[model samples]
Target: MEIKGENISFRYNIDSDWILKDVNIFLKTNQIIGLMGSSGSGKSTLCKILTGYINNYEGDVYLDGEKVNNNGFNPIQLVFQHPEKTINPKWKMNKALNESWNPPKELLDKFGIQQSWLNRWPNELSGGELQRFAVIRALSPKTKFLIADEMTTMLDAVTQVQIWQNVINIAKERKIGVLVVSHDKKLLNRLCDETIHLNIPFKIFFI
Candidate 1:
């Protein structure tokens, strides 16, 4: 399976400058690709566009040659930098997780989610714990591709390694394509099969 973004362009509004313009990207299920760019280069915006979060973009996002459908459960899932923003404050952690899909106990363990944390509200747990849930939530069986937008930026070094290891393992096992967007070149180098740089000119180069 593959996710392809063709002639993609976007801006905040008519008055604003284009953050992304005529950008094209492609990812295959067997590859773990990294996307890097300077601030304001629209890496996050492109991630949103690819995952159907930003529907007003100028071009098309296709999955296996068909236009992506955003109506129901999205095959392309995104795990954001701030996990707290993604979860509901009123719902318990378990509900937030189960809202996507019920993952197995072993999967939960691999992500370092404690059984007790599931019973607590989003506010009750630390950011790292909440992020663990967020990552797991995006790993539903129905997910065909995952866009990690600075997914581990807030976590400590140890936690970052742990989470990425688990996510990569599961993604490989399920043949899910992964797009990792990050500013840290070293982390990208360590995790990605190939890295694509999104420069100020909106040009993409594979390294």
Candidate 2:
């Protein structure tokens, strides 16, 4: 999905200062746009606003030229950093995969993940396996845009590279827009078509 941000600014509370200020950006269709920042640089906040996770903010987010006031119009899916946090503790992996907008089978194959892993519970899976499953869940049928907020941060270097390659290739092939929030410059440079650095002490630029 194509998206644009116009004069976007956000603050948590009236007493607190603004986190993101006067940001403007336009994302190319089917391109990976990386949001790079330090831990407290509001990269996650920006992701939330873009994905309609946090709607109580300022400015307009447009998808395909229509304003996104809520989650209805923006079909952005997220593959969060911690797989344990996102997946349910009680549910089986198969159940979780089944609940995804698109069944995990197709995406697993696309990502080169073995089909047998689906039967394994979250606890039984390795960190890399869990992360890959989370990504597969996000990229399912209903996903038009993907908001990957530090999605692969916890994985080992090899797994990170593998996941990054899979995501970039699949996203481009499917014409899926990817909004990635990460601190990894190497990964960003490898996977993203455009990169923007956020969370600077005072400066801001959409690159």
Candidate 3:
């Protein structure tokens, strides 16, 4: 399966400036693509468009040649840079993690999630711990494509490596396509099969 964004363009409002223009991107089930651009570039906006977050945009997004369905379980799952924003404050970690699928104990063990942390609220666990749960939740069996929008920005170096290790393993096991949006070139080079640079009124090119 593959996700394709063809001629994507966007702006905030009628009078606002355009955030992206004529942007084209594609992700295949067996590939890990890196999206990189300067500050204020529409990398995140494009991710939102691909994952059905922002609807008022130009052009089409197709998942394996079919248009994406906004309603119900989305095959394209997004894990944002901030875990705090990704998770619900009211729900406990256990409830949040198991919302879509019951993750295996081994996955939790690999993420280094303590059994005790599951009972605590999102605010109770540290940032790193909460992010582990968030990433795990995003890796449900139903997820065909996973979008990591700076997903590991908050964790320490060690924690970041640990999380990415688990994510890469899961992606390989499921043959899931991954869109890794990050400003860290080193991290991008380490994981991505190839990289694309997005410019204003964007033109995508290999970097």
Give all TM-scores, in the order shown: 0.95, 0.86, 0.95
Task: Give the winner by lDDT: 1 or 2.
Answer: 1
Mind giving the per-residue lDDT tens digits that candidate 1 earns over 1-207?
A: 888888888999999888888888888886899998898899889888888888898988899998886788988999987888889999988889999689999999888889999899999998888988889999999988999999999889998999999999989999998999999999999999999989887464432
- The parts of candidate 2 lying over 4 Å away from their true place are 69-74, 102-106, 109-117, 120-127
Who is ahead in lDDT, 1 or 3?
A: 1
In model 3, state the lDDT of residue 59: 89
Tens digit of per-residue lDDT, candidate 3, span 164-194: 9889988999999999999999999999999
Candidate 2 — worst ten consecutive residues by lDDT sum? 67-76
**TM-score between model 1 and native:** 0.95
Pull out the clashing pairs in model 3. none
Task: Give lDDT tens digits, candidate 2, residues 1-207.
Answer: 478887788889989988988777777657888888788878888877877778877778888888765435336787776788878878877788777565546657665567777677788887667877788778765678898988988788887777888888878888888988888888888788888888655525664
What are the lDDT scores of the predictions, listed in order? 0.88, 0.77, 0.87
The model with the greatest lDDT is 1
